[model samples]
Target: MDQRNALLGEQFGICPICLKPDPEHVDHDHETGKVRGVLCFSCNAALGQFRDRPDVMRRAAAYVEGNVWKPKLVAPGVYRLPS
Candidate 1:
């Protein structure tokens, strides 16, 4: 089996982050090309959006938990920005 398939088998074909089944993405270290594990599209996308930076992710988590401000949806396509 391919490395991705093998890792998926080890992870029970589920996303290690969200624990969703049929995880088709192979999460890896872009710099080192190391195999991390399998992840679903959403989780992988989130990581990519964060530039695979643990510091950024941690700061985001802290921001959410800190609750500095909460933005509200004002309309169907509009929302208020945090101050």
Candidate 2:
């Protein structure tokens, strides 16, 4: 039928990001204004708070996974993280 119905069917009515059911929000690319997938309220809000930055999201995921990077003092009051 419609786009929303199609998306829900495609995702099986679950939030793809969190794998939770009854997702109510349609997630989209802000810059491109393209529909990505259906997401639950929390997942949608999290993406909004992250400002849709994939790099930042990746770092956040890493931090959550306990792969934290400690900053090193390179100079006076200057901290740098190893790349």
Top model number, TM-score: 2
Cα deviation at 20, candidate 2, in Å, is 0.7
What RMSD, rounded to one decimal, does every model reach?
A: 7.8, 1.5
Note the Cα lDDT for every prediction shown: 0.85, 0.92
Model 2, 1-83: lDDT tens digits are 38987998999989999999989898999999999988999999999999999888999999999999898998999999657
Backbone clashes, each candidate: 0, 0
* Model 2: lDDT of residue 63: 95
**Local distance difference test, candidate 1:** 0.85
Show where candidate 1 strays beyond 4 Å: 67-83
How would you encode candidate 1's per-residue C-alpha lDDT over 1-83 as one tens digit per residue?
Answer: 49888999899888988899999888888889887998999999999899899977876887889855466889997988754
Model 2 C-alpha lDDT versus the unseen true structure: 0.92
What TM-score does candidate 1 reach?
A: 0.71
lDDT of 1 at 42: 99
